[model samples]
Target: NDLRMHFVEHSTPSKKNIPVVLCHGFPHTWFSWHRQLPALSNAGCKVLAPDMRGMGETSVPKDISAYDVDTICRDLTGLLDYLEIDKAVFVGLDFGAFAIYDLALRFPERVIAVIGLENPAAPHNPNKPPLAEYREMGADHFLHINYFCEKVGRADDDLLVRIDEFFPKVFWALSGEGNYFDTFKFPKETHYIDALNDPPSLPWNWLNIEEMQVFIESYRKSGFTGGLNWYRSMDIKWEQRKPYENVSSNIPAYFLGSENDVDLKGFHGDDPISLLRKQFPNLRAVEMVSSAGHLVQLEKSEEVNTALVRFIDDIREEL
Candidate 1:
């Protein structure tokens, strides 16, 4: 399964400035970072944001194995190779954050530093059970992980059939004031669509109509399978990561999250920044953007941009 990634690049006046690679998570594309591109470029930093293997304009592989973490890292490293970039600072969100952590661990020399938004760095845990067992353990509940992995094509079909309706609710449900966690109170037999739409409000202020249309149109053309494949590959990634069980990323790292991020408590039920620091000793800073949510970069672009520029400047000075 060959995948050619599409990326947007912004260059600064100084060619010597280290490039920063931005990676978007599920149901997002390179366009997700548009707000920060100009700001980073104006700050004298070269920025490149790519639509990872199976999402956006990138080639989507039919085989689930191709979406594994190792393959995704290879796709990214290969992108750097194609661009003739020897090294770069990696910035990512959600699924992209997971990929950045993997890249930093597997190829530290190629990474100057890592900046993760929303998601934290999780070191390999040998004691943790396989994804399947974990899914079984949570079978009584309606977890997105269980739904996506178990249902697979059916899940994709359901979402795709109701793409327009599904995207808006999911996006809004994950936003700052969405109160998405409350959906969990529903019975375990509740359908994902029904549960996800709980307390759904119209006209998400965080994302404008134009922005919402862009996402809807993109998903309309590409379908959800490409993005869902990333979820399907989780078990394979777990099995493949066995060799790196004791490994931890030693690269310079920083994490930023929204103060209102639902996933912060909904998913892990722990302080992500604290867990991140425990996993990454060189983690330089942890900041939370007030009144922001899972999509912090877009929801609070100015704050995210300022923090990123500051981090870039500090790292550049150290170099």
Candidate 2:
């Protein structure tokens, strides 16, 4: 577990307000928050965007057990200690969102508040382990969760070898215009590559050619094992979280997402926001951008920026 993390940091002059740490989700690096770094830092808040765990410039560990939530949260807490940061406002999306929420729960003393974009609470179901449900969900259709849990390198080889076909289609599939769930219609026998089709040539309204290539080239170099390892660790995380099954956090919280966000629409169960409110009584705002998708931050940068500034401001004022 020898690791080195790369992060983008913006210093703030405010003494009362704490720093803000931006965490990116799967298949993404710190560059995922390129839009937010300037905006949030411009608002007089310190910002740190890290290439979490195995993605981007960060070190990627081959061991599947290393990606568990305890170790992931420990990394963040360790970062805070290294920076001499007493506490900070943590904001995240997708896997990033789950990381920060777990951070708040595990090290409540080190977090001023948390803002989650596109994902609400940690994925939990007290009744049964999550993969059981994910497997059940994928029984009749092709579900990425169940698909990812394949014997070590199955999806990895299918995706990495077909890198040309994977990124654009997956990006578009999770966007407002495309349907991620459509891949589910493919029969179980289909490989992940065949199940995904080509997206209408890049340069969409949200992402440009250069922007998309950054992800493509980076993933190409990194091999995506580290990122996929996050998915591989889910069932393990579920089992480890038994002690916290009924635990809830009252740390101030907020959410930002796209109205058509695939995670909200499919994964988080119905009434996810209501579940959020119950988990965090001080939950303030749940901003959903219209006509946006899973990559809501980049898809509608302006809207996400406005909500982020206000959310950070509210938390800062309280500090």
Candidate 3:
């Protein structure tokens, strides 16, 4: 259904049948996990990373509904079916992580293992605050989530530059300064003054320039609407997930977050280990790597990779 899917396989074939399906989050493509592909592939798992509905080279859907989590998750299942694989270890980061949660719950048998990189939300995470509350936090700071919805047509209109050219700069600015545009191009020695003057930490600054550019190019051509469409479908997602309201995933699960990842700290409002453990009682491992930030796989690949390998290795027989 989606035409933009630019799926990339690893450089080598798997020595075993331990296949893995990796997913990317909003404002990113499968390219986000480029560093981990070869490592995982060499570790005896067939790894496949597809550009989710509208992010990378994936087909862009005209009907925004096509971007809904149910359909997007189904797209991954369809890819597996196309490959004739029964199930695989699924990994997602940020919005990609949310999609994985829905996938595991909706089709438990198809998921061998569930891993979330940064923003991990289980079926139990409370409903997000109302739009009004998020809006009060200010439009510039977090406009990406609700930009496509009807409520903020004004703000959307305000940011109407071509998505391709505009988003990279936006991401660069957000990732660089922390909160939106609080501190763009200022002296580091002036951080205290900068904080007092423009407060958001420029979280994207965690990424190296090259990494940020990769996202910019991918999102620039792909457009963020399809990815952003995930937010619009929240109501449909809620109703769809309601059937599984009582479901608690029995699959081995792991949640990894960076202690210094401002995105997670700013978003979750609690210690990730405590929050995720409480939400997922059967969670096998909850790891926090202090050296890393939002892009755990990119920032601290070895640590993230080691933790991931151990978890899957321990659970392979069950899978």
Candidate 4:
């Protein structure tokens, strides 16, 4: 893919434990796992949180096809190769979860196990192309992914200029305290800003204004193009996975979800965990943190850390 990746790495004193890689999803970066970084390190594991694909300090590709899942998995597996790590347990949040899941499916020998947060599996429907369905969903109402897909430069234009306004609302909107689905109340033609529910003035519990600026500053320079590319390549990713529609992965897997996260509520059908299990037959733990949203890692850091540490402990023998 010829992409330059930037990552934050921490090695435990012994450096004998299996390494851990953290992958972030759209509108997020490696820093998104700030709280979990030390927790994992203190748990006697080496941690590597790479700014996946197009987000953060990583090189952003102009070609949309570059963001497809296959390329993304190549980036991860290649990362492991370069680091001389034969295998590492992967922890992923949001779309990042899909990246690790795909990596495991394609390169199972390279993955020790997987710890998925928020998004449980690589989202796909064998019946129809993903973009077509998103377009259909956006036909009558505002769907953020569809906006990112169809609007093209327009979505980037609107969001890049509104980076300041977008973060707070979008952050709050995706939080357990916020209702992301409420944005659908907006008309089809609505701009993303107007559609977002106004968040309570900054420092709303889980995130403070200072913490929010980290995102604002990063996105202000990076723009939304790279992240949005993930949405645009939805159909490309779907087509790439056509052969494994009914296949199951035996990789050791664990899931951490939130009760109110939008992805949990409706996006992946009624039972995403059950659906995830169908794909990862060796699935071990399923923990759903209460009072958390899509950003469960940030909202419930303690719980998320506990689950991650326990998962690593449970799999230490394998490592």
Residue 163 displacement (Å), model 4: 0.6
State the weakest 10-residue window (summed lDDT) of model 4.
263-272
lDDT of each: 0.81, 0.85, 0.66, 0.87
> Which lDDT tens digits does candidate 4 get at residues 1-319?
5879999997667857679999999889888999999999999888999998888999999889998878999899888988899999999888898888888888899899999998876457789998888778778888888777778899999998888899999988899998888888888778888899888998877888888999889888788899999888888889887876787889899998888898767678666787789889999999889999999888988999999999999999765
lDDT of residue 226 for candidate 4:
92
Write the residue-wise lDDT of candidate 2 on 1-319 in tens digits. Answer: 2679889997667675459999999878998889888888888878999999998888899889999989999889888888899999999999999898888878899998999999986457878878788788889888787777764687777778888778888888888888887788898767776777668987899999899888888888888789999998888888777787566788999998888988888888777787777767789887779999999888999899899889988877777
CA deviation > 4 Å runs, candidate 1: 123-130, 133-137, 198-203, 269-271
The CA lDDT at 184 in model 4 is: 88
When summed lDDT is taken over every stretch of 10 residues in candidate 2, the lowest stretch is 10-19
Q: What is candidate 4's local distance difference test score? A: 0.87
Better of 2 and 3 by TM-score: 2
List TM-score per model, in order.
0.92, 0.95, 0.78, 0.97
Q: Estimate candidate 2's alpha-carbon lDDT, on a 0 to 1 scale.
A: 0.85
Q: Pick the candidate with the highest TM-score.
A: 4
Candidate 3 Cα errors over 4 Å, as ranges: 1-4, 122-133, 136-143, 148-211, 269-279, 317-319
Candidate 4 total steric clashes: 0
User: Which 10-residue window in model 1 sums to the lowest lDDT?
Assistant: 121-130
